[model samples]
Target: MEDTTQLLPILAVHFHNDLGLATANTLAGIYVGVRQVDVTINGIGERAGNASLEEIVMAIKCRGEEVLGGVYTGINTKHIFTTSNMISKIRKSTKNITDGILKNKGTYEFVSAEDVGFIRASEHGIRLGKLSGRHALKIKILELGYNFEEKQLEDLFWRFKSMAGRKKNITDDDLRALILDETIVPQIA
Candidate 1:
């Protein structure tokens, strides 16, 4: 990597998240002296998407001084959340075909699940499965109204993975149960 950088002098890194390693690899590039990176907000791109701008920016912001020897980008860290949300809404608008189905009953043939006395299983309607990443799991944890320290989150993540291996879809109930199990202390008489 260093030899190639020496030869090119202006080498850049661009990666896709098909294997969930794009962000990690991009950071590796920075470590190896690559000064330029091609990134997209929320990792939004073809297929699984490219390296996430938010993730890369936050990682550098949080750990660049200690880990990357003070390397940093010009990204405004505060606007990351808003930008991520905006990009998500844009993507959903393009891909979500069920947007009008809920508003107009006559749009689709199937009966409205809500009208049949059915309610959403989770407030955010998000389910974690095997391929889910740590960022997504953390967001879901926050959405579920629980906060864990880094170590606790690491432990919880492994537990979630174990359950996800067996369960096709991990619902809010399942996550709440896991949280309770981790937090509750048993009294020995």
Candidate 2:
């Protein structure tokens, strides 16, 4: 790989997640001074998928200072979840269209919702659901850049449960709306 880098202007590493080591291999390449890596959002790709962009970015952001000698990507980590959601929705829509043409509900659906970061916080190792505890909610809230007081979190949790009862899945958008509604102060006219 070192000799190959000298031959080319750019030595980008592209690895498939067939053995589920694409992210690790990508980081390995980066460690060896390869700056470019091919990655997909939510790791969705052909076959077993590709290296996860979020995983690589977060790994570098969290450990670059101490472990990787300050190697970092310019990715905005805050948009990771939203980008995953958008990709998941697009994939789902494409699956729906292909399913209609193929006359099979899952003919074009290769990845699971959880695999695409839908209804599950795989990075955090927590599955959000109606039965999720306050700790889980608090973690998600903090991840979304909201720092509510203890009492507010408690109140929000109850409201979350109320909304959760009606919906099969409460997405980040739902949570944001719930937070906004719960925290908004009404004024006297």
Q: Which tens-of-lDDT digit does each residue in 1-189 have in candidate 1?
A: 356645766769999999999999999999887889999987888988899887788788777889887899977666665666677787773222123332343565143333223344444334578866666677688888999998888889999999999999898889899888888899999
Q: Give stretches of model 2 more than 4 Å off.
A: 1-8, 93-166, 169-189
Model 2's alpha-carbon lDDT is 0.74
Stretches of model 1 off by over 4 angstroms after superposition: 1-8, 93-189
Task: List the global CA lDDT of all models.
Answer: 0.74, 0.74
Top-scoring candidate (TM-score)? 2
Residue pairs clashing, model 1: none
User: How would you encode candidate 2's per-residue C-alpha lDDT over 35-66 as one tens digit per residue?
Assistant: 78899888888999999887888788777778
Q: Model 1: which ten-residue window has the lowest total lDDT?
A: 94-103
What TM-score do all the candidates reach, one by one?
Answer: 0.46, 0.50
Q: Which residue pairs of candidate 2 clash? A: none
Worst 10-residue lDDT window, candidate 2: 93-102
